[model samples]
Target: MRESLKVQPHHLERDAYLYIRQSSMRQVVENVESTKRQYALRGRATALGWRDEQIIVVDNDQGESGASAAWREGFQRLVSDVGMGRAGIVMGLEVSRLARNNADWQRLLEICALADTLILDEDGVYDPTSFNDRLLLGLKGTMSEAELHVIKARLRGGILNKVRRGEYRCTLPTGLIYDQSGNVRLDPDTQVSETIAHFFDTFSRVGSACQTVKAFRKDGLLFPSRLRNSQTTVFRPLTASTANAS
Candidate 1:
């Protein structure tokens, strides 16, 4: 509840948009509390004198990254409504939920300012038309963008360091596994190991991936592949393209 947010009669005549978003699908699935908190903003709008119909929840962007607005249909809709003078207030958990990219955030700031729309977050309500509020929001957007960069840099650096130490654990290719002690080796399954060895031997003799694939097809052989994020191994038809890539 900000002093500047007086809820004028004209504001009551317009719609209130509740924007809900999470940076990734993993977060959307794991961060239940954050999703609940974002959805709770609809109650905030209602408390601010908006009827149920007057409040719009833009949650289609949920589980999508706020890093860019290009693919965000919900965010695009919100912006279109605000630009068309339909939005009285735009509420979210925070500015970062609305946008992590400064370009998108600044564009939103400009639209809200021009349309005289109010913005509400966990901190408080703000009028983007107000110089102080707009400045503060711009700073927050910059900080969010910088935060994304810092996080990516840290992750990349960590992965690189692990790689240099021969300790990086990426998704294992077919017929390979890491032991309890983190040493890379052929899969423990003898049949799988033998099949892989046969494939390589055949490929060496053929001197062409296309010929290897033909040989496998002629022999009715299947390639072993591990399913993602699982311990299950499956067999699949190996094509010429797949053989070349492997």
Candidate 2:
């Protein structure tokens, strides 16, 4: 008869990071306790013979709205730090903390996979080198993409509802005005808008954005995206004339 042996858990050492984020104030209050509990991931690292310096933690407080990628400042830095090879692993309270949007979420996951970064959750560790983990990551990214679609749908519905109510759903076009009832109306005095429209029409007929730009320069017109002097003229493209040439 063949003898069976119990397998010992794998023992290895690697740097790790703990990234935490909250979607709203509710998670802030309710999750802080759980958030502190996130330190237990450090214990996991410790068991692997990794020390404290090899680990990092990043968390966002009172973070809600989950829509803006710019909201998580520390999280973004942590990602950068990890990318620089300062650390070799990343952990989060869960997948949602990593990203609320598919783009950012998938980006972090891809970095981890490519960098051979291990991901840990309360259930267990995820080794990116594993074939099954890569496949599971793909599935999770797809699910996150679906989540992104739902969020965009809700935002579109809300904006459309506001528009249907005859309410201003967003700011006036640049150079327009908000009247007393908060309706946006064109400012008759700002000839800039008509100038811009004419420029676009002329450009379409001219067939080159660059040639149209030259025409604007000849006529002392300016692009809104371009910088302007106190007097403001596109003919003197400030960036071009002032900045060192590439």
Candidate that would win on TM-score: 1
Pairs that collide, model 1: none
Candidate 1, residues 81-179: lDDT per residue as tens digits? 999999999998988899989999999999998998998898888888788888888898899899988988999999999999988889888888888
lDDT of model 1, residue 245: 74
Q: What is the C-alpha RMSD of each candidate to the true structure, in Å?
A: 4.7, 9.4
Q: What is the C-alpha RMSD, rounded to one decimal, of candidate 2?
A: 9.4
| Tens digit per residue, CA lDDT, model 2, 28-103 | 7777787676666787666655568766667653364445467667767866875765556677766656665667
The candidate that achieves the highest lDDT relative to the unseen native structure: 1
Q: How accurate locally is residue 207 in candidate 1, as Cα lDDT from 0 to 100?
A: 92
